[model samples]
Target: MGISNILEPIQIGSMTLRNRVLMGSMHVGFEKLEDGVERLAAFYAERARGEVGLIVTGGAAVCQEGGMGDQYCNVYMDEHIEPLRVITAAVHEAEGKIALQLFHAGRYTNQDATGVESVAPSALQAPINRHKPREMNATDIERTIQSFADGAVRAKKAGFDAVEIMGSEGYLINQFLSPVTNKREDEWGGDFTRRARFGVEVSKRVRAAVGPDFPVIFRMSGLDLVPDSTTMEETLQFAVLIEQAGVSALNVGIGWHESKVPTIAMMVPRGAYVWVAQQVKEAVKIPVIASNRINDLRQAEAIIQEGRSDMVSMARPLLADSQIVRKSREGLFDEVNTCIACNQACLDHIFDGKIASCMVNPVVGREKEWALIPAEVSKKVAVVGAGPAGLEAARVLAERGHQVVIFEKQNQVGGQLNYARQVPGKEEFNETLRYYRAQLDKLGVEVRLETAATADSLSDEGFEEVVVATGVIPRRPEIPGVDLPHVVSYDRVFEKQAKVGRRVAIVGAGGIACDLSHLLVQDQVVSPQSAQYLLEYRILDAKAVHHLQQSGRKVYMLRRGKHVGTGLGKTTRWAVLANLKRHGVEMVTQIDYKEITAEGVIIRNQEEEQLVQADTVIIAAGATSNDSLYHALQGSLPVHLIGGAKEAGELDAKRAIYEGAAVGRAI
Candidate 1:
């Protein structure tokens, strides 16, 4: 894992980065807080101190119409410049360069959020957005181009090292470039050349406003991932033109926000979109940044060393581990907390108008508040359970100079994550366990595997405080014939202890059921390497690839509710359900559980009884709190119940980890 090209410094125009890693822009929901700029300053400074090559702030709207919401900073407002200076100054004080991303959401804007109708190249509505944007008149186009230029000028005044024009992800400039969105007959549309003019003009104007010496990076879509969208040839054409327009670098992004493709999900292979960036790199003279799903330094190194792209952009990975670069540079690869791409806390929260945080690293935006200083009085603590909650609590407590011990009944850590890792395409769950194990070891926390500690035992061992994070137990339904040998729990199936038949019926279509269904129906696990090979060489046609994706298994998910996969996050639910449908997994909802028979699951839907044929039945009927330890040790010693032991609503690891860390800090 020795890094070469990734760790090497590279020059983008006048800006010489310390390394080739760019902390890419992400909408972290910090800009709307009362002390938003201060929070952002601390956030960026921490990452800068971690030795990231360069930092790009989340998109700052150039105009009001282009603004994502009030939460996003607008460079058009003069009052915003001084506050943004705090961010650049903080990063500069940490000896790191910061870039301002000038953005225009265009048709992607929510009318309620912006208090204005969205605008696009044409009147075509974005599928994701509710309202159709008004077609831009001649004046609106000219004004928007000017807004970008003005925004760049303000960015320079705010002491930013660079400005990246946000042309990608179906934004204003990208809208004009794509024929699907730009159904216009004006000078801005009709053909590819005309369609590409807006982005080129924006880049040209921004470059002129920023001056020749100032760094100006243009972010463009390498692949639209939408039907009848900009083709690879047209994308390359845009890249070449934008390069000629005087941009210093091109940061290539994949898919629009509205695209059905799961670009940044866990199922997506690491460095999967580097090929798109490579295509752009081949077409342009400027430096190209390979983005989307490039998590670790090893992947970034390979991308740069193999000349796929000049640099790599890792946004969520930085969120998961702020010191990713420092850890990798020191050869402490295992210490690096990798982003699982769950999108549970980050993207899902953002989409829900909640403040974005990290699922793995919960103290992302609260850097100032949750600073882990040494404890005043170290105490001996016993954490029961080695799941996400217990592991995190132990790590934090030990780091704060507390003597900590974790007792896991299982032979290994990652209590429920052990089962989660068994799910197909969810192998990244192992990364979370790996990071926790490394952190626990580094902090000198004693982990007793296969040693179940009773409440009395913990008190007898002289532990002052105990954290009960024993996790949850699967709730078996009250149905007839539940004791059949063919019936199995989801955990048993995940553990490979039960023999699952070809025709399987899953009871309860929650997140776990969906994942189990996916596992049962996945014929073969395609490694990222093999997938890339198949894609690069065109070894499989579209039809053949589609065929290869399916398992052809007969699986039925039975649910008593109206919706399946209800426990999944907003950003991930659709993709998981779509994947299940693609693999031919039948999901039936709003049914009353009749009985679990050896032949199949018998259920009645809409007063119609039906026998769902299956050789094996899996019970994923949700979970209940395993708080027996909490109750037994209520007032014996200082005990805090956390994670599933406290509330097993949906087995949310995000909540568990956060609660664990909070208790650790409190202690």
Candidate 2:
């Protein structure tokens, strides 16, 4: 329907939000030991200016022992209150409400990072972190409860509108609630009431400490999403008890650190866990917020309109475009840069102990540094290659009131992005390309298709500035028999220029290799004509569908590294590997390539040398910078190199887009 429901104001306890959109808490690792306060204040202030209903600061550790170990904000003591006030004040100045999420990492925390023994309800080693936690005694339990209350008091003193008790995602409260982690036989475990006691008590204590008037939001896991974890029914029961115990609202999230279910990856469907929030909404009278993979305005609005949730929470979408709410409110949906949930930067960066950034939006965490300002004098700019980098540079330069033109050698824009979209489960990359295209049209950036750019031609055209985003070329490893007709690059396969045989051997273990393997093993029986005529018309039977999904191709992924898909994001690696396994794609790692024969490629490992039987060999070994034009045009014009032309280290879109934007802004 319409987005009126999402734009409508919502109330929780004594606080009234401007809209139903909440910037869900995400760990960005932006906290500093000395001057951390102002950095975070500026970060949230930008989002606040975007007019989000409420901004939930990334989880702030409630106690030193419960800290997340990395660069996380602390709200455990009175000293933290003054520094945190900076964030609350800045958000308030922008007429936005701010909430502090008080968290205890429990078994999910790393002992090496914290330099303290992690504590949980039971002495169990968490599967994901592999951290052995000390079972909480009576004193430790009391202290933990007090820590939550103390954090709440500090939050209130710091001028926070509310305090969200971190109860979900295998945190301290979730650990006690889940049967898989809470294997205790004390008053805090063994039974449903006892197991949920920690969460209930924390909510009650926080509510008491902050007074009955202040809002106390309990972030609950509607379902633990792991084996032997709390079920929907049990979680719903716990929700009821927590509401009665004094929770003003519930922020529902899915899965945990060890959850097998795909939660935030690109493969996960939007609003996949909204049903969990729906069930929780039905069970509790408090406002329910649904989160995880809620990427666009349509999806967020639908969640609220369909009576699934009272509000929608998103972290990645806002990270990609902080103006999501503002833009959507103005009916500028297409202008909004949607999050594709690639997790290439946000979640992956957090896992790698770096500040989280966005793949599509490069100016996420470094908003202050990458702030867009109008140019003093507009100039004619020529950008070579219409890939993500070139397109971004053109868009930014045009936005700065400069005349910009992008020259692409191919018939279409989106350099490798076009090939990227053809890969299985990567159709979302098209959305990013769409954003660039829209921005180009809106900003009046002239695009010339099938036109190769040179410094001589640009100088003849009277272009004042030039940017080279020539992108990359596939790096074919030098080996014997590589000149065979069957040996093709990944680009040929993606462009449908290469005909692959029943048996395929990929010569790389990066993301492209894995994606190619997935593409090769996909069901080949379902033709586009049949899919449109039969499946689209609902004329296909279950047997026919099953037949359409049968694949006869045998694929092998070979790598010199220890692991396949090593270049993949942490959140997506396991899932991609699992898909490869289910499709029976043989992964051969740590292999020394010998030579390619007429039949197959010969390889050597530690034990022996053998031939891998294959009819077609695909070289996805990697890409080298396509900088020949840049090198040739170096002294002719004031040319700035960007994207793959500048560096082809990891083939990361984040770096490409950011570099493009940076160069655009600088010139």
Candidate 3:
């Protein structure tokens, strides 16, 4: 597909962006110190340097009553102007346009963080955070609108090119717009027009504050994606109203924090929400920006070409690879590190009060700290194992002018990732592998496949430094009859080295166990590969569907913990659990493995012991470090151990990749 349209310049009010691609607002939770502001400046500046047209900064509170506290940026006070100017200046130096997303968290604000009672349209409690908000009175509403105007003035003075009024994602403006949250019979809540009055008034006030020539983008939810929330028609009506309210453009966002829908997960198809943007675009004369799940340049370009939306907005994709736009323009599209839609590090970290980072791009959130600079002196480096850690280490080292070689025991790269990709709905991991392969090739790194390397061997090869990313070995839990012929490890199952019988019992209830259970309960006759092919081609083969539906195997996922799949990411855990439930995979939690026999396995629950029949037993208890080479090479040469070799408690690609990148830069 031609990307000429995507690369074309677009005008939003008085500001003319370099291109149609915009970096949507996403919270990173950088510290509020002076240094933190500098770091934030570097973060956005990096993307600007990568040639993004316009960058919408993470949401900043507009008032003391709606402050997100110290963890997030706040412009409610006059003191914030200078610090924020640092970011705007840096972005401008890179020749990039920037917008400030003015926000009010409302009931989503944590009282513990803000030290103020949260306020909302009504007294209803937020669904996710469960914070009961005080109903906003007429005076409070007027004050909030003025606060938004004050925020706009501050943004304009801080050198921002534009301002975005955040009215989506269950925030204050969204709360008043939705009938579910606004239950008042007052003028601001009785009808759709009344409920929408708050957002319109904020937009009008902000436009007035910034002047008519300045761009004001109103970000509103297209579906809300929650029960009792505004419908699509209502959202379209909102689009028209906000356009009439003096906003220069519209950014169509999907879902809310309280929505039950999976808006950002891998299971959702790419551009699944473009229709929402198209509806709003058709309803309003102003340009519409589509947000959510736009991972590739072609997809973004196609959206615009098809007239679905005027511009494409991306958040996590930029976090994954800030240079996506630059790469696409340079025709290095294959080199772009596409976001895999794994919310493990970004969203999960934000919820846990940590700065958001990317699983694939380790330098994110640490742009200044991890800035890549050419090494003054390059040397020969040996990276053992070609998993996430080793590959990352090699990539960085090679980029810094070092001659790097990677040794893999297997015929191919991607150590545990090869097995991980076999899990249903995790095909996106293949993109990570592809990225590594392309990076290694581009960097001219030597990769020796089916070549196991020992410390002595690496030393004999005259390597200046060695990195041990030997990865991990799956643990075989000790049980009385674990040595039986039918007992196998999860890896063996994925490798097709073990034959699973009609009835299978999996030991452990983590991600691996859940994945194995899902795999085992499927029809043994039809390979997942074939099933995926049929699904991808949209060929509704009834026999294949029937075979999947009538899985003959009975699989039990046993866990010692109180809950199954406790280690799964919050965003993906529900989907995995639901798949297991649909397949009737039994989950036996808080169980102790007594013994295993040919007939079955004896297990003990809280109250009593029972014999669960199983023809085959698979152990997914976890893994232990394969660090024998690291230990053997400890004193021989300068060696660094990363990934599973450093810590084998859990399978975390995020830590592994980050450590690898860190070591790569260090060496």
Best by lDDT: 1
Q: What ordering of candidates by TM-score runs from best to worst? A: 1, 2, 3
Instruction: Report the C-alpha lDDT of model 2 over 1-667, residue by residue, as the tens digit.
Output: 3689899999999999989999999988878434566768877888888889999989999987788764678887788888888899998998889999999999887778778889999999887877788999999999989999999999999999998999999898999999999999989999999999989998888888988999888899987788988987899999999999988899998889888777888878778888999999999899999998898878888889899999999888888998889998888888889899999888999888887888898887777777789999989999999888998899999999999999999999998888778766777888898888889999999999999987789989998889999999899899898998889999899888989999999999888898888888984677656666777678987668756775779999999888888778888899989978988899999989999988899999896999999999999999999998888877777889999888985557888898988998999
lDDT-based ranking, best first?
Answer: 1, 3, 2
Tens digit of per-residue lDDT, candidate 3, span 354-385: 77899999888788778888988999999999
The lDDT values for all models are 0.91, 0.88, 0.88
Backbone clashes in each candidate structure, one number apiece? Answer: 0, 0, 0
TM-score of each: 0.97, 0.96, 0.95
The better-scoring model by TM-score among 1 and 3 is: 1
In model 2, which runs have C-alpha deviations exceeding 4 angstroms?
Answer: 527-547
